[model samples]
Target: GGLSNLLFKCALPEHILSVGDEPRQVLLRVYGAILQVSASGAGIPPDWQPPPRPAAPEQLQGSGLCRHLPPGPGLAAAPRLLRPQGVDSLVLESVMFAILAERALGPRLYGVFPQGRLEQYIPSRRLRTEDLRDPDISKEIAVKMSRFHGMVMPFNKEPKWLFGTMEWYLKQILELTFPEEEQLKKFNHLKTYNLQEEMKSLRELLESTPSPVVFCHNDVQEGNILLLAGHEASSSDKLMLIDFEYSSYNYRGFDIGNHFCEWVYNYTHDSWPFFKASAENYPSRQQQLHFIRHYLSEDSGRRGDTTHEEQARIEEEMLTEINRFALASHFFWGLWSILQAKISTIKFGYL
Candidate 1:
């Protein structure tokens, strides 16, 4: 049998899999699983017949509930999981975010399995760094992020401090064992700069900043934003945010700042274990204003209709806040990279 037939036989349940059926396209591979996604109207082979639809699960069978429950919107074509190994803890966080953000911001959750999850396969392309450089696209993203931050999701946990989390990760990196030569090379710079002192300073600066605490995507690199098809230049829903593994309630400015900082790193090359960071490529003051203005105005529902003086004041405050929190974003990712350097096998620069 072919690869598709084999995947169908091994991954799908007996009631759902039919002999000789082709599997869907592999949408993504991450954290030891492949996301096999199918479109709703894809044509099946002429000789193939689908298996009978199974009865609703037992939980949905009680109290005439099945009758009132609306039919799922083509969830049968939802993405399936192909995990040859156990799920990672970070993958569980992805599952948690998908479940919590369903119909709110992120992708819809179709089902969860011991090995992985089934999700609604959004037809989209991962955004490029240049796409984010477009003024209209940047504004739309700001507005969408503002709307997301404003929502009161059902999560009940206390807001975690962004700086505190960075410190925790840094501590973990300190505790890990490393080869003598590797330790000498990586630790020499830290010893010279007194990393503990720098971290303390960062903590103080972020704590002193007056940013509002809101639910944040935490990681907002270009790769996480998907550009959907058939959108006009100004459409708000053109870009969708994905990958919520590091999402949490934190200072709102941190999200915006992290995204801005992400512009510096280019991960497209085949160069082994290294990424290019050009300081000159960072967004300029005008660009930052362009993004921050949209974020602030949208959150306020003004959308640039404010008086010139009012707009200026808002821009000034936002610029100050974002600049300060950008430091926190840098520190957070810097520590995360250190930890990834020790454990991750992916050929990306972690230092």
Candidate 2:
């Protein structure tokens, strides 16, 4: 309870949402999900139960984090999604704008802005480390992908922000924490060489397409997604993707590639029961082929052109990226997690 991070719950018109604060304050980041908290409020919206009002202004000040954001009189968190940003405060701002704006086009987004109701945090319910997996999530994911790509304007900038720029940042995180200079050296070399070649190939790949970029959510972890379903009996469902801190202008393939890799990894890492609950027998290696085929079909230019050598080449490259990403996964996580573990140990000693 004494930890720096604080959680706040905000109320939107369509849904009751939750947000989190950074340790202490300053760059106050809001989580775009539901959480559990207890507080009281007034002037609350009718849709959701309004939180209790703050007894004093000092409590509402909230460690004086972001002066721009509205204060919650008193707020209690409810059970909702909680997705944190990996980057700094500035990046978090951009991410929120890009994502919330894109969602504004559809009613499903549920407004998150200066417009939300009086908010507060109550501790009645606590958000779990993870959420229960949903069955129709994939179909919902596809539609959300389409919606995001459909909304938002393209990014045009000089010097260019390459697809893996975020990965580069993550690599920096890895290097900072990674021990064993040899491991660092090997990864740096591998990344440096692959990045150069990948950038070159990516540039060429983009040359053939004149499509404008959409506000891209570079990371689509399940924690960052919210489902909007009309009813249990109805087939209707839509998803709102949150956490755009790494929002950037790049090839749509980059986003697709990451999400594709995510699914592959998600299915694999899940326990057998977790895997089955998500539906279907676990994806066999051959099922990956069908997934790839489905992915390629999204390329409008490559449609009905299975025989086209150029398209074939692109598909091959995508497959290659997947394999490379898979292999690099351990390298990245190992580096970051290792540093965190080591630092944590040194700071407090073995718990």
In terms of TM-score, the best-performing candidate is 1
Query: Could you give candidate 2's per-residue lDDT for residues 1-351 as a string of tens digits?
Result: 111123433222233233563122222234321122101111112123223332222233322323333322222221221112222333344445644555463222232342132222222221111322233445445555655655544344321344344344344343342354754565555455565455455456456543345555556645445444343423534445544544555545556545544543332224432222232433334544454554455545424455678766766665555544443333333333322332221121111
Off-target runs (Cα >4 Å) in candidate 2 are 1-5, 10-92, 95-99, 102-135, 150-215, 264-351
Candidate 2 has its poorest 10 consecutive residues by lDDT at: 37-46
Model 1 per-residue lDDT tens digits across residues 1-351:
011111110123335543473432212211221222111212222223223233323222222111112112211111122222123433555655665556557766645554344444566667776777888888988888887787665553455646546655655555555454764487556556766788899878877878887878877877678787677756767878876656767888888888888888766545855457767868899999988877877777534367889889878887888888888888777766665454443445665
For model 2, the local distance difference test gives 0.39
Report lDDT (Cα) of residue 35, candidate 2.
Answer: 22
lDDT of all predictions: 0.59, 0.39
Q: Write down the lDDT that model 1 would get.
A: 0.59
Model 2, position 52: C-alpha lDDT score? 34
Local lDDT at 181 for model 2 = 76
Residue 249 local lDDT, model 2: 57
